[model samples]
Target: MKKIAVIYWTGTGNTEAMAHSVADGARTAGAEVAIQCVGDIAADTAAGFDALALGCPAMGAEVLEETEFEPFFAELEPQLGGKTVGLFGSYGWGDGQWMRDWKERTIAAGANLCGEPVMANEAPGVTELDECRALGEALTK
Candidate 1:
């Protein structure tokens, strides 16, 4: 089975909720999955996973949360060569630049995005959550 890792950091539970849905979809497609918060993640854990799902909310000026998620992901960037990755997040405002910039950063860091970034304006409703799951399945396949 394909093993996937979902790493996220949520301040208001929106991204965390999305992470669960992503894991659900990955499992539905027969992939083994581990969902973890950024602080809980151990370096090199992605070594065993076939795909990666990364989640974080867009911070001020459409930047990544620097305290935890950014640093963790920055550390992860080095090890992501040849890895399949999916990006997801919730944004309160702006033009979704965070996702776009994040996509660019991930690509530059050597991780191939499985598909377009999944994002919601605030908390995800059913439709957005469904899309997140679909993204997970697609990433594994």
Candidate 2:
């Protein structure tokens, strides 16, 4: 079975909820899914997954969570060459510039994105959650 890692860091649990839905959809699509907080998984270990679904809510100035997620992502970025990746996050303000920048970074790293990156403003609504699930399923493919 394909193995997928759903790793996330959330300040308000919005991204965390999206992470779960991503994992659920991956599992339903017959992938072996492991979901964990960003702090719980090392970047090297997360990079070993067959596919990745990464989540982090937008922080100040519409950037990724600076402390944990950013460092982890930086470490993992070098290893993402030719890897399948999916991105998701929540933002309270600003356009989803974070997700856009993230997608560009992922592509520049040579990672194959599963689909369009998913983003929600504040808490994710049902539509956003479903889109997250679809993102997960796309990763499994």
Candidate 3:
């Protein structure tokens, strides 16, 4: 089975909810998955997974969590040369500009995105959850 990692950082459990949906989808698509907070993920552990799902809620002034998630991504970004990557997150306000910027950055890092980043305003609702699951299943292919 393809090994896929779901790495995320959540302040209020919204993004965590989405992460679970993603894992469920990946499992349905026959991918072995590892789900963890970015803090728990090893800095040098990118090579073992065929696909990666990164999550971080929008933080102050519409940016990724600078201290943890951003830095973790910065470390991982440098080496995503040929990885299948998916991005997801929750946002409190604004028009999902953070996910947009993040998607652009992912492209710049040489990763192939499964699709446009999946996002929800606060938590994954019924439709959002389905989309998140589809994102996970697509990562396997």
The best candidate in terms of lDDT: 2
lDDT by residue (19-138, candidate 1, tens digit) is 999999999999999999989986577545788999999997899998998888888888888899999999996889998999999999888888889998899999989999998998
User: Considering every candidate listed, which one attains the maximal TM-score?
Assistant: 2
lDDT of 3 by residue, 9-121 (tens): 99999999999999999999999999999888875795468999988999988899998898888888888878899999999878988888999989998999998789999
What order do candidates take by TM-score, descending? Answer: 2, 3, 1
Q: Which stretches of candidate 3 lie over 4 Å from their true place?
A: none
Write candidate 2's Cα lDDT for 51-81 as tens digits.
Answer: 9999988887878899999999999999999
Question: Which candidate model has the greater lDDT, 2 or 3?
Answer: 2
- Each candidate: what lDDT? 0.90, 0.94, 0.90
lDDT of candidate 1? 0.90
Error of 3 at 74 (Å): 0.5
Off by over 4 Å in 1: none
Q: What is the TM-score of each candidate against the true structure?
A: 0.96, 0.98, 0.97
